[model samples]
Target: MTAGLLAPPTLIRTTRGRAVVLGLAAVTMAVEMASLVVGRSIHIGSQPLSASVLPGLVLLAALGAPSVGRAGDRDRLVPFWIAMAAGLLLGVALLSRTGDLADLLGLVVAAANEEIVYRFAVPVVLATALMVLRVPTRAARVAGYVAAGAWWVLLPGHQAQTDGAVAMVTYASFAVISTVVVARSRALIPMSIAHCVLNVITIAHLRGDITSGGRGALSACLLFLLVGTFAWPGDRPGRRAAATDDGDQDLVTDTVIDLRDGQRPSVHRGEDLTWVDEPSEDDQPEPVGAPGDRRSANHGPPRH
Candidate 1:
C-alpha cells in the first residue's frame, strides 16, 4: 500500500490546514521574538502563560487537539497520562546533572511553547506536505523532524552548546525515537507535553522544586513509561471489530490504535498497518437470490 493510504489524518491533512497552522505559528514566533527586541523581558517566559505559549495554545485550540480526551475519546487517554508521568520523572532526574538553572516555571512554559511549535506543528505540517508529495511514510516522518531539531540547536545561539558531534548524534537519535512515538500514539498532545518536559529538565530541574542526592535515585528511576501506552488495559493495539464487506476476507490482528482528530472506524491490519475506511451501506453488495437463501443471508446488506 502507498504511504498516502497509511498516512494518519492530522490537522494538516490538507494544504489549507497546513497553511493556516504554519502561518499562525510564524506570526506568533515573530511577535514573541520581537518582544525581546523591544523593552519587554518576557522572552524568558512567565508563570502562567508566556508569550511563547500563546502561539502554541492558539494553534492547538484551532486544531482541536485538546479534544483527544473527550468523552468519546476517553479510551485514548492512557498515552497522555503516561506521557505526563514520564515527563515529570525525567525532569527531576536531570536536576543532579544539570547546573546553573533558569526559572523553572518559565523554562517549562517556554519548552511547552517550543513543543507546540517545534515538536507538534512543524512535524505535522511537514509530514503532511511530504505525504502529499507521495513520499514514503517513514522517510517523511524522519525528514519532517529535521526542522524542529535543527531549530532547537541552530536557530537560537543558546542551543549551540548542544551542537557538538555527540550532541548532534543524540539529537538525531531522539528525532527518530520521537518520530516513532508520534506514529504510534497518533496524538500530538502527549508528544508535545512529553517534549516540553524533556526540554526543560536539563535547565529547570524538576520544576526547580527539590534537591537531593536523590538525583542519582531519580535518575535510576527515569523509566520512559512510553511502552505502557502501547494499548489500553486488555486492549490490543491493532485489533478492530472486523468489518465484513460481504465479498472479502479480512484478517485483522490484536492491535488497537486511536486515530487523531476522532476519525472513527478505520481498519488496521497487522504489520502493514494500512488504514481502510469503514464501508458504507451503499458500498456493500446487494443481497443474492431470494429470502431464506444462504447467499442472501448477510443481514440484507447491513442497514444504514
Candidate 2:
C-alpha cells in the first residue's frame, strides 16, 4: 500500500485527462496553502498545531495512499541510510549548539511538509501539466523539477532570513538536489531525510551556532553534497540487478509460451476426426467356425 502512493501517475493519454489532473493538483495546492495560513495563525500550547503537525500528517497520508502503478526502480535502503546518517550528523551538530527542543520539533515538521509539497507534489503536477501541453517528456520533467525547486526557494515564508542572496542560493540548491533525487529515484523518503538535515543545518547556522569561519559549517556542507550524489538513480548497485532480473523473467515467460504453443499439434481439417477403436493385444480373434458362420456348414441345397 505504501508502495502505491510512491508510484508515478499513469501516463496522460488524453488531453481531457491531463487537464483534469492539472486542475485537481492546482485546487489541492490552493487548499493546502490556505490551511497553512490558518494553521500559522492559531497556536496550541505555544506551538501551532497546524504548522507543526498537520502538514506532516497530510504528507504521511500522501505517502501511504495508493497510486496508479509502480514506477522506477524498487526502493533501496542504501540511499535512505546514507541520507539518514548525514541528517543525523548534521542534526546533531545543529542541535548541540542550539539546545532547543522546540526548534528541533519545528525543523522536523517543516522538513516533512516542505518536501512533500515542494519536491513530490508540485513537481509531479507540473510535469503532468507540461506533458499535457505537448512538451517532450525529458523537457517536461526537467522543467517541473527546476520550477518546483525555485518556488520553494522564493516562497515568502522561506525568505525571512538574513543575507537574501545566500539564503536563496542555499535553499534553492537544496531544493534542486532534493527534486532531482525524487525525479531520478522516484522515492521521496531519502530526499525528505536530506531536506530535514538541510533545515536543521540552516536553522542552526541562522542561530549563529555555526559561524562563517567555523569548520563545522564546512563539514556539514560537504556531508550534504555527499548525500546529493546519491540522488542519481544509477548510483544504486541494486538498480541494474533489478532491471536485469525483470528482463530475465520476461524472457523466460515469453520462451515458455512460445515453446508450449509451437509444440502443439496442428489440425489440417475444419472438423475433428472421428475416433476409431483398434484391436487390443489381449482380445481373441473371432472363431473361424462360429455358430453364425453359415459358409462353413454343409449346405443341403447347392447352386444349380
Candidate 3:
C-alpha cells in the first residue's frame, strides 16, 4: 500500500485509468449539483465545509495518477508562496477587524474546497479525457480550463444568487483567471493560496470590514499583482533550466536516430533547421612535408 502510494503516475496511461478519471469527473459534477439542491455548506462549529467530497477525492486521485505530456514539468512553488503571503495578510486583516475565528476558518475551507473542485479535479479529469481521445494537447488543455471555469460560473448556487451584472462579471472573471492559472501551471498549491486570499477579501467585503469599493479594488489589484509577478513564466530558474536541458537532449536523440536510419537529419541550431552532412575520409586534407625537407629538395633541384 505504501509502495502504491509512492509509485509514479504511470497508471494514467492505461485505459482503465482514463475511465476512472472520467468516472470521477462525472461523480464530482453530480455531487456538486446535489449540493446545490441541498445545502452548499455543512456547518461544524464555526468552520463550514463545502459539500465537495467527490471533488476532494478526485484531487487526491490526481495527486496519485500519472499524466501524459509535460504535466510534471510545470509545478512551480514560488508563486504559491507569494499567494500564501497574500492570504496570510488577508486573514490577518480580517481577524484584526472582526475578531471572528469562525469566519476565518470558514473562508479557508471554502477556498480550498472550491479550488480542489473547479481548479484541480475538474480540469485534470477533462484534460486527461481529451488526451486519451488524442486531442491536440494545447486545445485539450484550453478546453479543460474553460470547462472548469464554466462549471464554477454556471453551477454554483451562490454565484447564481449574486446580485447585479457587474458583480457577476467580476466573479466570473476571477474564477476564470484562477482556473487558467492552475491549468497553465498544473499545480494546485499556488491556486489554493490565491483562492484563499480572494475568499478572505470577498468575505471581509461582504462583512463590511472593507468599508468601500475603493479599498476592495486596491486589495484585488495588489493580490493580482503579487500572484502574477511570482507566477510569471521563467520565474523558477531551476525548472526552466531543467526543461531546456530535456528539450535539448530530446532534439539530439532525434537527430542521432535520423542519421543512423540513413535519413537527412535536420538539426535546429538557433532558429533554422539546417541539414548536417557527415564528413567523409576523402574530405580530409593530406599531410604536408616539413619546411626543411621541402627547401633542401628544391635547392638541390635548382643546383641540378
Candidate 4:
C-alpha cells in the first residue's frame, strides 16, 4: 500500500488574499460589536457617504487587487472599472427608489466584510489547501467561495428576513461576480466597485420592502449560484506535473517473475504496478538484470 505524508502545498499568496482575510477579521469584529450594541436590531436609513464610500473602497482596492488576477498580472483594470461604474449607476437608481441612502452606505461597509470572508479568507485558505492537495486552481477558487458562503449562512444569530436572505444573495453574487471580474481585469478595482455598488443597490431596494418567501429563495439562490460559479468554465486549465524523489532515490521498475498464486497489484509510494499474469509453478525463464541493478543476475527469483 502507498504510505508517507506529502509535503505541505505551496500557495502564491496575493494582496487580495491578505485583504480578504484581514477584511474578514475586521468585519467579524465590527459586526460582533454591532450585534452587541444593537441586539437583533439593524438600522436602515440614508447616509451621506452611501454613494461615495463604495467608489472609494473600489479605488482603495484598485491599488492592491491587481496581483490576484490571472497570471498575477495587471491586465483587467479597465473592464473592472467599467463594471464598477455600472454597478454604481444601479445603486443610485435603487437609492432613489428606496430613499434610504444611509442604509445603503451601511451596506457598502458591511459588504466589504464579504470580500474578507469569501473573496479573501476562503479563497486564500482553499487555494493554499489546493496547492497542497494538488487540486486545480480554478476548482479551488470556486470551491473556496462556495464554502465561504455556506460558512456565513450558518453563523449564529443570522436572521432569515434581515441577515440570512440578504447575506445569501450578496455573498453568492460576490463569489461569482468577483471571479469573473478578477479573471477579466486581473485587478480587483472593477470587481470591488461592482461589489460595493451591488450591495448599495441591494440594501437600497431592500429598504421598506418585505416578502415572506425571500429567505427560502435567498438560500436556494445561494446554493444555485455557488454551483453555477464553480461549474462555469472561466478558469484556465492547470499545468501537468510529476513528482520526483531526491537524487539518491531514483525510481526503478521491476518485473514480476513469480506470484503467490493470487497476488494482486497494490499501491506503493502512490503509484500502481502490475505483476506478470503467470502461475508461480510455471517456472518462468531465468531472470536477467538489464540495468540499475547492483545485485548479481544469478540471485534469487523476483517476487510479486
Which structure among the candidates has the greatest lDDT? Answer: 3
Model 2 per-residue lDDT tens digits across residues 1-304: 1123233232122233333334444554565567656644334323343342354444344434212111233353455466567666776665666565555555665566666666555665676566556565446656866887787786656677636677577677666666555544444555555566666655567677777666356546644553445444445555345435332111111122122232222333333421122234555333354344455445743355
TM-score of 4: 0.39
The numbered model that scores best in TM-score is: 3
Residue 109 lDDT (model 3): 60
lDDT of 1 by residue, 4-103 (tens): 2123234334444445555665666565456435535454423333365677677666555321211113554565476566766555455435542334
> How far in Å is the alpha carbon of 172 misplaced in model 2?
2.3
Candidate 3 residues lying further than 4 Å off, grouped into runs, are 1-3, 6-27, 37-40, 44-48, 54-83, 89-99, 130-134, 233-304
Worst ten-residue run, lDDT, model 1? Answer: 247-256
lDDT of 3 by residue, 205-249 (tens): 777777668557856775565345434454456434644643211
Clashing residue pairs found in predicted model 3: 9-66
Q: Candidate 1: lDDT of 287?
A: 36
Q: Give me the displacement of residue 281 in model 2, in angstroms.
A: 63
Q: Kindly list the per-residue Cα lDDT of model 4 for residues 128-189, writing each as its tens digit.
A: 45534645434655576566555554444333444556667655554565554433323333
lDDT of each: 0.46, 0.49, 0.54, 0.40
List of clashing residue pairs for candidate 4: 9-132, 20-120, 45-102, 45-103, 46-101, 46-102, 47-101, 47-102, 76-185, 80-190
Considering TM-score, which of the candidate structures 1 and 2 is the better prediction for this target? Answer: 2
Whole-model lDDT for model 4 versus the true structure? 0.40
Candidate 3 residue 6 Cα shift, in angstroms, is 5.2
Q: Which 10 successive residues of model 3 have the least lDDT summed?
A: 248-257
